[model samples]
Target: MSLDTPERLPASLADYQALAQANLSPDVAAYFLRGAGAEQTLRANAEDLAALRPWPRACKDLRGGSTACAVLGLSLDAPLLVAPMAYLPLLDPAGEAGVAAAATAQGVGMVLSAQSAQPMDHVRAEGSNCGWMQLYWLGGRDATMQLAQRAARAGFSALVLTVDAPVHGIRDAELSAGFALPPGLRAVNLDGLAQPQFAPLTSGESLLFDRVAHVLPGWEDVAWLCRNAPLPVLLKGILHPDDARQAVQAGAAGVIVSNHGGRVLDGAPSSISALPAVVAAVGGAVPVLMDGGIRRGVDVFRALALGADAVLIGRPVCHGLAVAGALGASHVLRLLLDELEVTMALTGCRTLSDITRDCLGPSPF
Candidate 1:
């Protein structure tokens, strides 16, 4: 019933959610758990993924099979990575450092959020494996470039530029709960940068259009970052095929099909629903990754069958972290990987490459 009860262990990823909710304050839980608006897209992410059925095979040679793969030239034990989530210190005292340690222990990569509660260098030092830094536009090019360069200096291997959320989503749950960061914990990585200031809006003018939209990054900015960044830039939050193509044209190293975990744009398509088209758009020019509603290992297989070269997990790992810090987070990953291997064995997929669209049947939906 409590985080200190180490004897009780979560048997499935879903179990961690309840455990986490129990461990966290009600307001904090709402902040971490809710999606934008009506949460239609949030529910759809899992629902649409469940609609696809795996075409199970009875027998195969089943020899020399492995889940190992590589993304952006970095080898991985499985096609899994931790999606960047901000303010981990709110979940546990160990914070992002614990998550990084957990990812390292599991032989997967961790993408540290620009809004991370821990300093980038300290978190990177906790993990020896691949680490990526997720970047938000930070109002303009100079500040953004400074953060990217800091990640490079901290030993991060790549940069994941989140392009979808130009402004924060209308998260009803967070608003209702009145969520605010507790004192002494903040986005330490963003310290010393001047926050963007906007001119006062005149009455009857659109606040979003008139004041906020001007600072948003554009295609030219993506190209600029790709050309100048010390690390390879992967554009996350891509859903539309045209945008995917544009990302590749902008010289991106990869594209991540995400709706910002359904935390942005309530009616937007789930990452799973959008993956196939994004994959086709890029046409293998760059790796295509996705993150949304990945609750089980079978979901990971389903994503691969659709087109994602790899997948990132967000809330479930946080759930684990809330329950028992690094050990719980690592256990969540281990459970998923074990389930993925089992699903592969049943579907006759010996390696990640073997998990093709053929491994799937028509959607039950």
Candidate 2:
């Protein structure tokens, strides 16, 4: 499948995934597509969403429908954003810059990854709608703050602190594939910053518990970043309802209900299954966003029905990038948005506000 021209683009998001599977190197595919442990949670993310059914409304006035919405003060064409993914250069030489351009051209938001292969300023310059920067606590507050300050100076509108997976997950597929970044491709945004160091492990000590855990960010760190960072901060990778409440109390601007796209904990519940609880916990105090297993426009509608202010997509965009650089990425968003509009029309929803829980029927799960 040569996806060199726009005319050759796939018709649906699933097709894009197939194209990506056919196109990407096996190592890259395994790294990007697989999840942690037995992949129980990975499969659940999509399967749970598939179990849900949307109740179609018949013969209602369908006029002036629009998917436009606001999140963290940024107006978006659709309640959609490209979730951050690292080292896009592996898929195409254009890399994060290409994804940024696609997001900007589509009038959707994008969150630049902390491990981006392209410089923050270069991506920002390429994407006017690129408003958020996703951050991982780089061992401590000061080192992490430096990245936050850099993002602010580059014109990003928000900071998304990924609080889950203080360490990398046990990804069996990635290990089997021997995934390693190709030569010359690196996290350009992290340049010049000192990497985190830990005391040498001693015999009979757990490496993760004795050494790595010492540098993990806690509630205090979250509060400090919220209070001191240059931009509004939103905590990503939250699943517990209590954590959602804690994030708000810590002065976070918002909360993203995610399970690290089911890549962190194999048995964790799907993002959709946990969303209503988190939303209830938030109690309208802040915006609630979601990610994981959002492959169709109907999934977006399903999320909004359950109380997600917006949704982000990770693998689908990467699949598109792997297929045809910026064009494939942009086409993927277009297909989803177009499908969202059609779904809205069929469900008798004229606006985003019209999508409520009543629009949903019983889920098989």
Candidate 3:
């Protein structure tokens, strides 16, 4: 059931997700949808977000309300950013390039994955000045530094170091379906690069510590990256308050409170659940951002009310990409922004700042 031009664009984010699954092959859809282990965290991400209720304030001056915000000195039409998601080529041949063009045109920021289908320069050209790059600590210090330099040269304003996935998660759905990356789809930016590998697991040695641990970078490496990198470095995949504190101490310009979208460490806490603590831990030293299970405009308002500076939207954008390339992706963003503005207007909040904790249900924080 391919969505044609008229039917391709969805009126809601959830519709986009459904249409994307309908259009993509089962293998690809499973690859995109699977979460790690038993998926407790995956379910929890949406559940926790749903638990948050908004308190509507009626009868206020609603003449000239705007959803614009400034994050890291960059003006955004809405306080929404496209999270760094990999393998856009799997969704459409236009890949990250198409998504980048849409994001730039929509006046939102985008973060290209370290594992993006296109190279840094091409993605940057497509995304224009609003593009940021998400980095994985590849192999060792030198390769990581080289990637950073490349991104800097490509004019990425910020560097997002994804610290959660030192190794891929145990995705049960992908395993059950025997899903594999299709031929011709590769992380183009990492072409010709040597990734760290580990020896076969020895008897009695845990797969996590013995195999995965070998490639993981430590806190000192994170600190070194902060000092050496040319751009502001943000530590993504941070959940714990302590880790958030450590990231700030290591000179991280910001922290993205995420559980790797519940794709890593399945039983791990939901990102929204972890966000408040991380926000408290940072204590305003650095901006705290969050991602995961953001499906609606009210969810965005809830996230901000819960102390997040901004929120990154992931799966919905991918859904849009899968459905109608740039058109679908940009429309998804526009829908969210439009919905957010409506939520603001109805709630009597004229500005993003007016959306404070009091606007939400009683907070545990």
Clash pairs (backbone) in predicted model 3 = none
The residue-by-residue lDDT of candidate 3 on 242-355, one tens digit each, is 999999999999999998888888899999989888999999998899999999988898899889988998988888888888888888888888888888887789998899
Candidate 1 local lDDT, 332-359, one digit each (tens) = 9999999999999999999888889999
Error of 1 at 259 (Å): 0.3
Count the clashes in each prediction. Answer: 0, 0, 0
The list of candidate 2 runs beyond 4 A from truth reads: 1-7, 198-205
Best by lDDT: 2
Assess every candidate by TM-score: 0.96, 0.97, 0.95
Off by over 4 Å in 3: 1-9, 362-365
Q: State each model's C-alpha RMSD to the native.
A: 1.7, 1.5, 2.1
For model 3, the local distance difference test gives 0.86
Off by over 4 Å in 1: 1-7, 199-205
Q: What is the C-alpha lDDT of each candidate?
A: 0.90, 0.91, 0.86
Q: Any residue pairs clashing in model 2, and if so which?
A: none
lDDT of 2 by residue, 24-89 (tens): 788999889889999999889898888778899999898777899888888999999999888998
> Candidate 1 has which clashing residue pairs, if any?
none
